[model samples]
Target: MGRYILKRVGYMFLTLLIITTITFFLMHSIPGDPLAHMAKNLPEQVKQNYYKKYGLDEPVFVQYGKFLKNIVTEGNLGESLRYPGRSVTDTVLENSKVSGRIGFQAVSIGIVIGITLGVIAALFRNKWPDYLVMFIAILGITVPTFIIAALFQYLLTVKFEILPTTGWGSFKHTILPTIALAFTPIATYARYMRSNVLEVSNQDYILTAQAKGVSQFNIVIKHILRNAILPAITILGPQIAGIFTGSFVIEKIFGIPGLGSYYITSINDRDYTMIIGTTIFYAAIFVVAQLLTDILYGIVDPRIRVSNKDQ
Candidate 1:
């Protein structure tokens, strides 16, 4: 198990290196200078000084090398070109709190609601409850999150004045975004889990348990649920990480501070450091999440863990 984890971590670093290299050159290849905002109508000497200050005067390869070194050795992401002296690491960490919190709530809500709906639908297959679950799942999948957000803002806030339409720092404000974000995930898990449970129900063990007169609830909680939920766990791991870095659109529409806003702004301002820093940070999160997911597979299924160990 330890060896497998180390191997996965090694692969994660390799993937991150590739992503960094690709992202770095591609960003530079775009037809704009990071200092363009500073360079507009500026004197030549001042522009040159600015270039020197940010190391833009250095060759691209040299800058890339130093960029890798700073992150790998000094554990630094340097300064934010947009904020001027604010460390990229600090900026992201501070802003990520809101994003992380929202993501946690969203994913939690998604799993609980989705699993419950799915299990109910599966257990009551072809019944009214099944129809209702399927209806909700289909609706969530069809609707875009923003539309959901807008509708929530309007109905809950505009019409009834039950919830705030915008802003953060309060549970009331979190309601709209969390629901909007969680709905799709709810739909996704419901569909997948419903199918998985139906299939698992047909398994021989399930039949044996039912024939042995085990209570329906015990069979479901012990026999059916454990195996049925494995697939959801596998997919949910990376999604948990993804939801954190990817609420950019949601955050913007609702005016929440997060890495997403910084990322979009950095591109527009051509703040190269901030752009690369955030990209790398997000990539790292994604890679680690995947690694953890793989590790979790071993825990969930000892058969899988034993097979990998033998290899």
Candidate 2:
């Protein structure tokens, strides 16, 4: 397990290196200079001086080397062109708090509600409850999150005056956004869990348990749910990570001050430092999530341990 973890971490570092290199060159290759976007009113001579001061006048490779060196030694993400002396790392960290909070809430709600509904639906297959849950799941997958958010904003906020339309403040402000983000994941989880449960419940072991006159509830909980939930756990890593990154659109629409909103603004303003900083942050989160998922697989199945030993 320790060796596996070390190997995974090594791969994560290599992935980050590749991402950083690509982001560096791509940002540099864009048509307009970051300085030009920021200092539009400045005279050409002044702008050239600014470029030279920032080493933007240097060869791309030289600039990339300096960028990499700054990251390695100073732990700096460089200064933001949009905010002059401000460090991009600081900006992203500040905003990431909000995004992280929303993502946590949404994913928690998704997993809990989704898994419950799925389990229930599987247990009571073809019943009214199952049909109702399936219908809702279908809607979740079909509707875009933004559309649901917008509709809720208009109906719940605009007409009913029941919820806040935008901005982050109290719990009320978070409810609509969280629901919008969670609905799709809930749907996905429900469907996946339902299928897995149905399949696992029908296996020979379940029949043997039944033949042994094991209590129905215990069989469902101890046998069916444990074995069935493995796939859902595997999907959780990417799903949670995706929610954080994909929140960019939702954050913008809702006027929430989050990493997603910051990323969008940084891209629009061509803030190279912030862009790369956020990208690296996102990549790191994805790597960690994937690692966690692998660990979870071992926890869910003792067979995995036996297989590892055999190998």
Candidate 3:
């Protein structure tokens, strides 16, 4: 298990390095200067001086080298163009709180509701409850998140005035956006869990347990749910990463101050430092999530550890 974990961590580091390199070069490759968009009023001589001061006048490779070195040694993501003297790190930290909070609530709500509905639906197959759960799950998958977000904003916020329309304030502000973001995940989890449960419940061991006069509830709790939920656990890593990334749209629609909003603003303003910094933060989260998922697999199922050793 330790060796497997080490291997996974090593792979994650390599992957992150590759992603960082690609992202850095690609962002630089885009036409027009980062300062061009910002310093429209500055004279050409002043603009050139600014470029020289920032080492932007240097060769692309040299600039990349400096950028990489700054990241490694000083942890500097460069200064923001929109807000001079402020570091990109500071901006991300300030804004990320809103997105993080919303993502957390959405994912939490999604996992609980999705898993429960899925289990109940599978357990009561062909019944009214099963049908109702299936219908909701299908709706979640079919509806786009943006549309759901818009409708919730319109109906719950604008029409009824039951919730606030925008900004992060009371819990009331979060209700609509959270539901919209969580709805798709709820649908996805329900379907995945239902399939897994249906498969596990019919396995030979399950049949044997039933034949041995095991209580129905115990069979489900001790055997079915345990095996069935394993696959769902694997999905959690990507799901978490996705929730953070997906907040871009949700934040914009709801006028929340978050990393998503910061990213969009940075891109429009051609704020290179802010863009790269946020991208790195996001990439790191994704890498860490993947590593956690692998470790969780071994912890959840001893069979995985045994299999790894044999391999």
The reply for model 1, stretches above 4 Å from the true place, is none
Model 1, TM vs. native? 0.96
Indicate the residue-level lDDT of 279 in model 1: 89
Per-residue lDDT tens digits for candidate 2, residues 184-226, read 8899999999999999988999999999999999998999999
Candidates, ranked, TM-score: 1, 3, 2
Spell out the clash pairs found in candidate 1: none
lDDT of 1 by residue, 98-131 (tens): 8878888999999899999999999999999999
Ten residues in sequence with the least summed lDDT for candidate 2: 302-311
Please give the TM-score that candidate 3 achieves against the real structure: 0.94
Clashes of each: 0, 0, 0
Candidate 3 yields a Cα-based lDDT of 0.88
Task: State TM-scores per candidate.
Answer: 0.96, 0.94, 0.94
* Candidate 2 Cα errors over 4 Å, as ranges: 43-45, 309-311
Q: Please list the C-alpha lDDT of all candidates, in the order they appear.
A: 0.87, 0.88, 0.88
